[model samples]
Structure formats: structure tokens, C-alpha cells
Target: MYAIVEIAGHQFKVEKDQKVFVNRLATEEGKKVSFDNVLLIGDGDNVTLGAPAIDGAQVSAKVLKHLKGDKVIVFKKKRRKGYRVKNGHRQALSEIVIEGITASGAKKAAPKKETKKAEPKAEAKPAAKKAAPAKKATAKADDLKKIEGIGPKIASTLVEAGIATFADLAKAKPEAISEIIAGVRGNHVTDTWPKQAKLAAEGKWDELKKWQDELDGGKA
Candidate 1:
């Protein structure tokens, strides 16, 4: 039997005893791990497909090792600004071997609940706090790095350009966004940035992620 499962952020077709390398997992080496996001299962002539993911279906595996992948060079340049950045990156990876595939009755591991400590008795009532005007929290910039094709420099540039939040980015036109980042590097495609930011601003993460998967950098 073989199963298509999502490990880390990527999916793979795995079978018993098959070794696979995936994005770095938090589980330690030699530890057993189970993936409940089973997308499909096939056993010879019979096939079971999931509507997104099958309930109670799971793929078990053991972490064999952790390692780094080949280094990739990243170079960025800003037009006529003498701004240049260069770096190298290696993807952290984990090696694991498929142990078993369960068709049903697989229980998901529940997260450990945090214990709450007893609050110390306050001499003054909480109503006393209401007397003081509430201070508004300072708005913090959203991580634009979460958007595909937007690196640290571009994110900083966008933030400095007054497009600090996802909502701000969503309201920007593609042409305006392009002009805003014209000082920075390559031929960037900004047509999808507003769309992606809109989804993020609306808290539609899954839909945004699905759309991101289909995108090439920021291109549709």
C-alpha cells in the first residue's frame, strides 16, 4: 500500500520503508512521528481519495537524520542607488523513513494543555484600572516576508514607503506598487501582491496559501 501525505509544507507519495527527505521537522532524530494529513491511499486496484484530507487516515514514519541542502546564492540590487545585497542559503532538511500506513482508526495526537496558575489576590479592584484611560497599542508592521518573492530588503522598502500593513498593500495598485519598488532590483511582478495581501488582510490564510502554491514567485 502507498499513501500521498503532506509532510512539512510539501506532499509526497510514500510507501512502507521508503526513505524521504522533507523540510526540517521539529521532531528529534530517531523519534517516531505520524502524519494525519493523508490525501490519498492506494492498494493495488482499490483507491481511496480524500476530500482535502481523509479523517482517521495516517502515515507513520521515523526521523532518520537532520541535514542541510545545497547552498543557493541570492543577489539583489537597487537601481541607481548603489544598494546591493548578496547572500547564500541552505535549506534545513530532515530524512525519514515511512514505517506504516493506517487506513482508519488513527488517532491524532492532542496538544498538551498548559496549566494555569492561580492568580494572586490584588489589594485593589480591577474596576480601579477602568479609571485610567486605556492606551492604544502601537501598530506594528506585518511581516511582508510571508509574501512569496518579497525578501527582507523589499519588505523594508515597502514598510518605509508607508505600505506597512497587509491592508495597505491590498489597497495599492499594481502599477503604484511597481513604481514604489522601482529602486530595488530585478523585474518584479506585482500584479498579485494586492490580491495576496487582500487575502491575508481578510484572514483567508488557507485560500492564500493555496493560491501561493500555484504562483511562480509573485506571478499568477
Candidate 2:
């Protein structure tokens, strides 16, 4: 019998006693592990498929060893820009041997319950004069994409990082902005982002546009 199972974000067709190398797992060498994401099972002419993953179906394996894969070279160059970079990387991997396959037997793990702590109540104080009514709450967000060099994804990332408004972006440090979007694709220059945001927040559209015309993708 053979089964298709997902291990470490990758799928593999495995059978009893078959050894497979997969992405690095937290399991230590000589430890046993089980995969509950069994997609399909086949024995002779009969086959059992999962709607997504069959309930209670599991594939058991034993960790044999941990190792690194072959090295990969990455090279980058900019034509007529006197820029060149080269790097090498090796992927961590784990070797395991399939021990057994169960159609239905493994039990799902139970969820942990959260316990809230009780707080002590404070003593009541004398009442004071009432203040004026507070202003209505509204969700006001600035268009971060209006700043040159910021695309939809980068804008969303900045918003997630708490820089949602032009004022917020204007107060952000260039180093912090670079760190926030470090994982984003391509090279980005944030030297002019705060300057652009400052102009936009101050409602100087014409000046901001004029400055952007002199800039290149938010670079100085």
C-alpha cells in the first residue's frame, strides 16, 4: 500500500520502509513523527481519497538524521551601474523513513483552554463636573500609495506596521522604514518618503507633485 502525504509544506508519495528527505523539521534524530494530512491511499484496485484530508488517517515515520542539501549560488548585477552581488545558500533537510500507514486511528490533538486572571476593583471616588461631549469616532486612513515608490503591497505593509497616515509616515525614521519593508521585493530607496509624506499631510499637492517629478522612485 502507498499513501500521499504532506510533510513540511511539501507532498510526497510514500510507502512502508521508504526513506525520504524533506525540509528541516523540529523533530530530533531517532524520534518518531506522524503526519495527519493524508491526501490519498491506495491498495490494489481500491482507493480512498480525502475531501481535503481524510479524518483520522495518518502516516507515521521515524527521523533518521538531519543534514544540509547542496549549495546554491545567487548572483545579481546592474548593467552600467557598477553593482554586483553573489551569494550561496544551502537548505536544511531531514531524512526520515516511513514506518506505517493507518487508514483511521490517529486522534486529533485537543485545543488548550485560556484562563483569564481576575483583577482587583478600585475604590469609588467623588463625582466631578462633567466635561464637554467627545467627538464622534471615525476611521480615517491616508492613501500611502500617493507617496512615490510605494505600491499596493508596500502600502499595506506600512499600514500593518502602524504607519497608516501621512503624518505617521512623516514622523517615521528612514532606517525604520527600510527595516519595515526589508522583506519586500526589489530595491527601495526611502530617503524621500518622509519628505513626500510631510508635503502631502500639509496639503501641498502642487509642491509634492513638483518634488516627485524631480525624484526617481522615491530616491533622492
Candidate 3:
């Protein structure tokens, strides 16, 4: 029998006694961990698939060791900007051996019900009641990189200058927007930026997408 399970956001086809390396888990070495996010199981000709994940199904495994993967170099450069950055990264990983697979009847741990004594209600006076405090308005920041020709550097630059949302971008002038992103080291055009941002802020994705298709890197 073999089962497909999700461990640390990655899926794997595993069987009994199989060794697999996955994202680093918080479990200590030699400790057993059970994954309940089973997606599929197959035995001979019969197969069982989950609606996202099957309830009462689990895959048990024991952590063998932890290790780091090979270093990967990430390089970024901008033309004529004299800007270049390089970094190396190694993903932490854990090795585990599958112990067994339980086909059914695995129960999730239930939280203990707390028993609290009921308190007597206080009598309210007929005089008056205190007013509730008002909550401050919070603004949601949009992904400025979604705009055509707006890369990470330009997006961050705009954000640093308080143009963090699509609404703010929609209200900004082309010349002012250009000045805001001047330090980003790119000859970016912003004539259609406000229009695009207006469409995006209004949630007109289809219209924005069609307009972007006709645009040449945010130029008119």
C-alpha cells in the first residue's frame, strides 16, 4: 500500500519503511510525528482520495536526522543602475523514515472542556451607561508590483514615499510619481500608471488585464 500525504506544505508518495527528506520539522530527532493531511491512498486496484484531506486517515513517521541542502545563489541586477545584489541560501531539511500507515479510525485530539462557575449578574442602574471606544481606521496595502513596469525596487520606493496602495497611486500625478521613483534607477514611464491603478483599485481585473496587454511597459 502507498499513500500520498502532505508534510510541511509538500506532498510525497510514501509507503511503509520508506525514507524521505522533507522541510525541517520542529520535532526532535528520533521523535515520531503523525501527519493527518493524507490526500490519497492506494492498495492494489482500489484507491481512496480525499476531498482536500481525508478525515481519520494518517501517516506515521519517525524523524531520523536534520540537514541542510546545497547552497543556491540568487543574483539580481538592474541595467544602467549600477545596482547588483547576490545572496546564497540553503534550505533546512529533515530526514524521516515512514513507520506505518493507518487506513482508518485515527481520531484527532479534542480540546478539554473547561468548567467555569457562573457568576451572578450585577444589577444595572437607571442613570446612564458608558460609551464604547471608537476604533481607528486601518488601510490595506496593495501589491504595487501588480502594476505593469513596476518592479520590486519601484514598488518599495513608491511605498516608502506613502504611495503604498492602489488608491494612492490612482490619485498621484505622472510627474510626481516619476519623482517618487527617481531613486529606483530605471527610466520608467508613468503616464498610464494612475489609470491602471484606478482600474485595479476598483477591482476591474479584466479591464486592467486587457489594458496592460495593450501597454508597452506602462507607456501610453
The regions of model 3 sitting more than 4 angstroms off are 105-220
What TM-score would each prediction reach against the true structure?
Answer: 0.47, 0.48, 0.48
**Please, what is the whole-model Cα lDDT of each candidate in the order they appear?**
0.74, 0.75, 0.74
Residue-wise C-alpha lDDT for candidate 1, range 28-127, written one tens digit per residue: 6799999877878888866766545665689999999877778888999999999999976666567999999998943221121124223212312332
For residues 99-172, what per-residue lDDT tens digits would candidate 3 score against the true structure? 99887843222121123222111111111121111111123778988999899888776765457789988988
Q: Which stretches of candidate 2 lie above 4 Å from their native place?
A: 105-220
Which 10 successive residues of model 3 have the least lDDT summed?
A: 126-135
Runs with alpha carbons beyond 4 Å of true place in candidate 1: 105-220
lDDT minimum window of 10 residues, candidate 1: 107-116
* TM-score for candidate 1, residues paired by index: 0.47
User: Looking at candidate 1, what is the lDDT of residue 213?
Assistant: 98
Candidate 1 vs candidate 2: the TM-score winner is 2
Which candidate achieves the best lDDT against the true structure? Answer: 2
Steric overlap count per candidate: 0, 0, 0
